[model samples]
Target: MSQEIESGELDALLPEGTVVRIAGNNRTKWDLVGKKGVVRNAQTLGGWHEVVLEGSTSAVRVQRNALEIIAIIPHSKVKLAGSLQGIKSGDQSSITKRRKKKQSPPMAVNLGKLDEDTLRRYRRYFNLNVRKDCEKDELVFAVRRHFARTKVDESDVIFRFLTRIGKFPE
Candidate 1:
């Protein structure tokens, strides 16, 4: 089945609950949802964070945000959430070099450590219910949709959302 998926014809036909590898030229794989995930700018970078959703080649990369690499995971994979540690400060240039040496893949991070105050702020501003078990991407999309509808600045809602999900500023 993995072989068939690698062949590309069945890429679009991949079943909803199936686990597929997402990577770039580096060959480091990140898990992704066949649907239900939203790609957006990480609030800190001001339009630099993006999760590319394509068949077989999906990846998350930092362009204008930071020198780090990011991986987007489905809410169902929250089990892997605890590993989402943002790149250490000043380590941006080393990500690519480390990859070239076949070093261990970047760490995955969990979103549960966000401050309660930040979470409350997000909930109050967006009218979202960001309970402790809520999925990160779901909260992000909810805020994105709300901002789009109300013509509000993303800063008003994005910071609190990212804090909850454990993603760093762009």
Candidate 2:
């Protein structure tokens, strides 16, 4: 039996065990009401964030700006997990503390032999300013976010990351 949903009734229907994966724009201003264990993964939820909630057997993409819900898999009823652990943005202490901790030495990479265009692209993209006292590995890790955030083709980005980290699949 389907009942008429009132104001705030839809949010109330969110049962426990919902895994919300957000991307693109709606990552910033979403709030979970009458629910706990809402997980968020995004660099920033600035513009139009896209949220995908995966149920046990199905998933739904919720557009916050438009307040629209696109359901996946109609007949096969899916169960949302109720017992999820909540993850929140880390506090300032953790971020700053980690930065203060010294990083280990860098591995030998023959920086001079690296291709000129490859060097230029990474240098421009990363805006790296190496200091004599700074460690090479730390410099790379520090600019890792810039490398991660560069606007590259989606397929290329995946390939580049996997290649840089050397995590190729068999």
Candidate 3:
């Protein structure tokens, strides 16, 4: 049975929980060549993506270019509480669960790592008001607020960032 889906539903950068098949010609990952797996992490290290093979608990890292996206697991299934059945939360010494930090989009998306000057420059490019005397945190917060206020496509935001950083030709 073919599980082919519409190309419009797929994106080049696979999101987490996206099912994928390793390419047959993937010379580096010959052992698992042509195997199917679900994406656990999109960007584990540089261009590497972590994938969990069928019937496996442990995940393996595969190059992004070597994987072909099969299907995207709906957000409803992925966001249903915790999905891990047997994996430990890694708090052996503590009895209480660790509270997840409340973060804005800038911190959530790692935009805080960018220097204040760079952030200010990008804000200017985006037509965001920036004060020369304002703190770096405030600038980052504004960026977070801008996205959080609207229903913006994350991939588009990432693409814009890449273009601003000159990583991609405009």
Clash count list over all predictions: 7, 9, 0
In model 1, what lDDT does residue 43 have?
A: 35
The candidate that achieves the highest TM-score relative to the unseen native structure: 3
Cα lDDT tens digits for candidate 2, 1-170: 12233434233333223233332244333443212222222213432222333322222333333232222212233333432223332211111111234445874444545455555456566566654345545455545545555576899888888988879752
Candidate 1 residue pairs that clash: 81-109, 81-110, 83-108, 83-109, 84-108, 84-109, 111-165
Q: List the residue pairs that clash in candidate 2.
A: 16-82, 17-81, 17-82, 25-48, 25-49, 26-48, 26-49, 27-45, 28-45
Better model by lDDT, 1 or 2? 1
Instruction: Give per-model CA RMSD.
Output: 22.4, 20.2, 16.2
Each model's lDDT comes to: 0.38, 0.37, 0.65
- Which should have the higher TM-score, number 1 or number 2? 1
Q: After superposition, how far is residue 48 of candidate 1 from its true place, in Å?
A: 30
Cα lDDT, model 1, residue 37: 19
Per-model TM-score versus the true fold: 0.19, 0.18, 0.38
lDDT per residue for candidate 3 within 1-170, as digits (tens), equals 13444443342456777666777444446888866667787763556777787667678888776776555566555521223333223312211212445344654577789898888887788777767678989899988787577587889999999999999999
Ranking by TM-score: 3, 1, 2
